[model samples]
Target: MTNMDTLWLAPALVCYALSAVIFIAGRLTRTSRASGWAIYLLGAGVIFHALDLTARGFQAGNIPVGNFAQALSFFAWLTALASLLLIVRLQMAVIGAYSVGVVAATLGASAIMMKGGRIVLPASLQSVWLPIHVTLAILGFSMFVLASSVSLVYLAYESQLKAKRPLGPASERPPSLEKLDRINYSLLGWGFALLSLAIITGAIWADATWGHFWSWEPVESWSLTIWILYAALLEARLTVGWRGRRAAALTIVVFLVLVGSFVGVSLIDPGKHGGWFG
Candidate 1:
């Protein structure tokens, strides 16, 4: 199973890395032709990644998120999938270029961790909610990643415009500020909904598995804090008409907190969810 899994993942990694390179080079060279080809390469990488994860699911008799490595790999797969879908809709290859490299880096980390040995799912987690909770959490996190990436681009573009600086080469011109802001809001809405579901399902799972609904575990506390933070951000955007630089900056900051909570807390602390890194 490991050997077969590696066979599919190897090509997927290659495709992701090559796509990022081609996209970056195209941007640097200010040529649309290379960027066009880069999109196809990214699509191919997503296909290969999907196949590898599907195979792993069958082999493991469950979703393949039994450890930190598998979790990260699944996260990369979902992020790449979301990026491809959004890039096609936005007709923006540059955004894909900006994000695909991060996806590749995530997969690379997963591959490195895979060498440690096979990871077994804890018996306590072998429930129907396993897929439900993990998928919702990871998918929500992926949307946050997309939102923050676009937010960073929005910030840079807005700063340049305010300074009356040139927008630079055609390849470097991100989507307009209004468009970036709208996309960020849309992604955040979706992420918030999914994250809310993930939290609820996790609570249910905890009760069934551990006879408790809420433990205030480190990861759980952090998750709730992230949820509240986004909720406030969205409320401000909706009620206070928050948009542009302030919105983008807050989105990026929220994402940083999420990363610290998800990765840092989950690995360092030994709470219920933290020790699942295997």
Candidate 2:
């Protein structure tokens, strides 16, 4: 990484840390000022994150997706961006703590894994479809992640209500179950659409580079599994009138599958996609 890249990392870390604190404060104090601070911090982080991505692109002379570290960093920022947009729309600053934590963890992991060695892009990843596929896939994943977080929060809030307990710091100010359910559905819809687009682009890229569109590679298989899970969740929500706890539980399962696809596959069976981290 260049000096420019390293410089951006500091600002990004600071933003995430500050956002996390502000989010917690907002939830605990029920103060709009805390949420406002979170928004500011998130905006600063996004700017720095964009700068970092630009630096990487400049270094690569193309869209950079060669190694694992870059992919992780990109996905982290994508998640942060998606979460911030949702927070703005929903006015749910309570979710900021979880979202910022995810950003910080991913960024820290990427920093640890990032090697300074230059990587040559695989021939198969050179087509225009590469960018579309990656962007959509990352966006889809981000949405799913956000949905999962909201589901978890919903469950926690429900538990508190059932027990008639006082709300804790994190649970002090949360949206209603109905609102969380609606957000989850919206995220699922958006995520499913993006996932479909990603799969289509992946198929096209595969055909262009490898002469085949569907090879059932490990990464491909796992991604398909996640897609199917989310599809089922959506169907259940619409047809079965699944809501509240049931819907949140299903979303939790889907997110677990997503995590397995992202982390488990890489560890269990290294394949063409194994080079993502290195």
Candidate 3:
């Protein structure tokens, strides 16, 4: 069963790698078929990833999120899932390259951790809120990933426009600065809202199980900090109609802070949530 379950992941990783290449190749050649094919490949990858998660869940008899491997794999699935939902709508092939890379890397890490051993899901984590909190968190993180990648592209798009570069080949990809900024704003709003819900749900679960909430754990503190940073960015973008390099730069900074708070803090000194991913 373990061998069969692990086998579910191999095709997913390969498909992700293939999809990324196809997306990039499509962009370079300005071919619609490339984008179409890339999405198809990504769809296949998402399927295998989901199957891997399901197989692990069946083996564990739970959500398969007890430890690092499953947790990481779950988020990786969500990220790809998020991209799948957005790409067709956004029609932004370039974003696929970034999203696929993130998904592939996370999935790769999950595969590596699986080499250690399968996690024994702690009975303590068994609760209705586990899925709720994790689902929200993964969705929120996926949004942040999309927003940051869009911002990076925006900066490059803006720079190229500013430099008066010839449209020779560069025009084949990367949406206009205005469109990219709009996409960024849209992503931020959704990400912030989801993240807020994740925090609220986490607090509620804490109080229900632990008899209190707001423990000021490192994870909790950093989560709030991230919420605030994104909140400010959202407000400024909405009210002041801010755009351009500064907004893009701040978006990237917030993404880094997210990494520091979640991944970085987990590595050094994690609270309860540290072992999950940090």
For every model shown, what is its TM-score relative to the native structure?
0.93, 0.91, 0.91
- For all candidates, what are the clash counts? 0, 3, 0
- What is each predicted model's overall lDDT from 0 to 1? 0.85, 0.80, 0.82
- Per-residue alpha-carbon lDDT of candidate 1 for residues 1-278, written as tens digits (9 for 90 to 100): 36767878988999999988887776566555777677788889899999988877876578988777888899999999998888888966666656787898999999888744455676777889999999999999999989987887788779989999866677556577889889999999999999999999999999998899999988899999999999999999999988899999999999999997778886688488753566
Quantify how close model 2 is to the true structure by its C-alpha RMSD in Å.
2.6
The candidate scoring highest on TM-score is 1
Model 2 TM-score (2 dp): 0.91
Best by lDDT: 1
Alpha-carbon shift of residue 268 in model 3 (angstroms): 1.9
Candidate 2 local lDDT, 1-278, one digit each (tens): 55766878778878987887777676566555668778888889988988888888777666666787888888889988988888898877767777777887887888788777556676656667767888899888888888888887788778888899845456345678789888988988998999989988888887887799999889888888878888888898789898899999888887887887778888787576775755
lDDT of 1 at 6: 88
Q: Which residue pairs collide in model 2, if any? A: 67-276, 68-276, 68-277
